[model samples]
Target: MTVDIENLIDGESKFVSFSEKISLPDAYSVNGDVLVKLSGKISNEKKGLFHFSGNIVAVLNLNCDLCLKPFNFKLDFPVNELFSRSIHKKDDCLSFSGNIINLEPVILDNILVNMPMKAVCSNNCKGLCEICGHNLNESDCRCEKEHINPKFEKLKALFEESENE
Candidate 1:
């Protein structure tokens, strides 16, 4: 998305808002289309410097890490960016060539930075059964429950002896 600032004058601010469905490139394990809603105001602070402050809201489709189920995650955050029309790009501000400022890069960066490391459908998700590879949240599996690692067998016997005493 690009913002037009050709008619904006110095010391003047414009209120811009838009709701668009954007297809983000597959990134950070996020796939499919996203609904992005941006509402902000852009102000020309000086001759070639602009300041934009507003909020960004987006809905992302993600899969649960534990259950492997697809779900929607909503992200809402504040954004404050500086734009400059200088020939020499500075490390602190974003540089633009013409009277338009590209917002896609900023939006993508914020979304990726705020993405969760682990996604879960719910807090009490049971995940999948280890032996039968069945979704334990739906129903219990018929696999044997007494299977224990040989390394932990001695520990289990010690606990049993202590309980008897």
Candidate 2:
């Protein structure tokens, strides 16, 4: 929701309330989803100063980084911030004034900052077999020989040459 500065010029306080479903398209590096229930309160305190606080709850459906399987997760976050009319000239932080505040960017930033960098299906996720692309968590593949690094072969050859010399 957008807050108009004109309505807040006189130090009058108001609330920006929402209980709608919001979507996070790029929830993960590959494919992931987050549906949030958002509700918040915002108030104008003084000239160029505002207070924003709220609660957000989300259900996340994402692929496990190791197992490559879908996992359901939950996230709960409390939102609180201050927007001042005077900008800090030397800092990267933002300044707000003239009674206008657009909340979409703020919400998005909070969500992205709090998201998990890596999520696994379980603590002991077996992950996929590198040799055959088989999910080791479910079943094992008969391919015993694993892929070896070409760099290792070169090192081995160097060691043999040194031994012969």
Candidate 3:
């Protein structure tokens, strides 16, 4: 959705409320849709700079990094940004030239930044067994598991002997 900044600037409106249902494209692999809510107030911070500050709330569907299980992640945070008719190299802000502002990227970027680097269902997730590539959380393996490195057998024997003593 696009916010018509030019219209807002020229009018007497001081604040704006926006809500949108955003779904990622099939090629962009996030699990589910996002509901983004933004309420911002427009202010003239400097001579002509339009500063917008607001709150953004979103629910993102993410997956467990290790087990690849889907889960819902909630994001509620503040957004402080500047929208300008031209680019400002030194200032930290988003550029908008025309009447339209494509807020999708801004909303998406904010949500993504809050995403966990390593998402897990829980701390106790058993995860997949390294030896047989079996999902330990789902089931157990009955077949005797071999050591990843054959040389570890001697060390295993030593450890067993120590435990016996």
Candidate 4:
């Protein structure tokens, strides 16, 4: 949505509404899907300021770090932003250009900020089997469970010899 600064020049207050399907770049493109639903309410108080608050909903196709399996995850978050034409901007204020204020960047910024630190399919995800490269969440593996890999056997022996010395 674009807000016209001229509308508030006549001492008139206005509210602009927006609801649309927007697309984000492939920065997070594991499955090449980054479309989202963006909806918001922007209001001008006629005091040379605009307040924008909204929510973003998107289904993220992410790979589970442990299992390495692709899964569909729902991501939703709220956005609170302030836009103004004043030269004296607040700490979190964004400045607009000319007589128009574009909202595309604002919405994308909020979505990036609200992204999860980690993506996991479940709390107790069994992850992948190391020996057979199988997804443990789906099936069980007969491979013996060892904390240390056999490749590090020499390092373990050296450390054990040092302990005896």
Estimate the TM-score of every prediction. Answer: 0.83, 0.64, 0.67, 0.71
TM-score of 3: 0.67
Candidate that scores best on TM-score: 1
Worst 10 residues of 2 by lDDT: 27-36
Question: Which 10-residue window of candidate 3 scores lowest in summed lDDT?
Answer: 4-13
Relative to the true structure, how large is the alpha-carbon lDDT of every model? 0.86, 0.71, 0.69, 0.73
By lDDT, the candidates rank as 1, 4, 2, 3
| Candidate 1 per-residue C-alpha lDDT over 10-120 given as tens digits, one digit per residue, 9 for 90 to 100 | 999999898987788776446667889999999999869999999999988888888788778888999999999988787989999888998888888888888888898
lDDT of 3 at 103: 68
- Candidate ordering by TM-score (highest first): 1, 4, 3, 2
Q: What is the per-residue lDDT of model 4 for residues 46-135, given as tens digits with 9 covering 90 to 100? A: 545777777777777777888988777777888777787777876777888577888778867776776678878889999888888888
In order of listing, the candidates' clash counts read: 0, 2, 0, 0
lDDT (10s digit) by residue, model 3, range 1-165: 566655454434467688878886442337556677888776655434567678898766767666677766677899777766655533677776656666677777776676677778778877777667677778886646665566788888899999999
* C-alpha lDDT of residue 84 in model 2: 71
Q: Looking at model 4, which ten-residue stretch has the lowest summed lDDT?
A: 7-16
lDDT of 3: 0.69
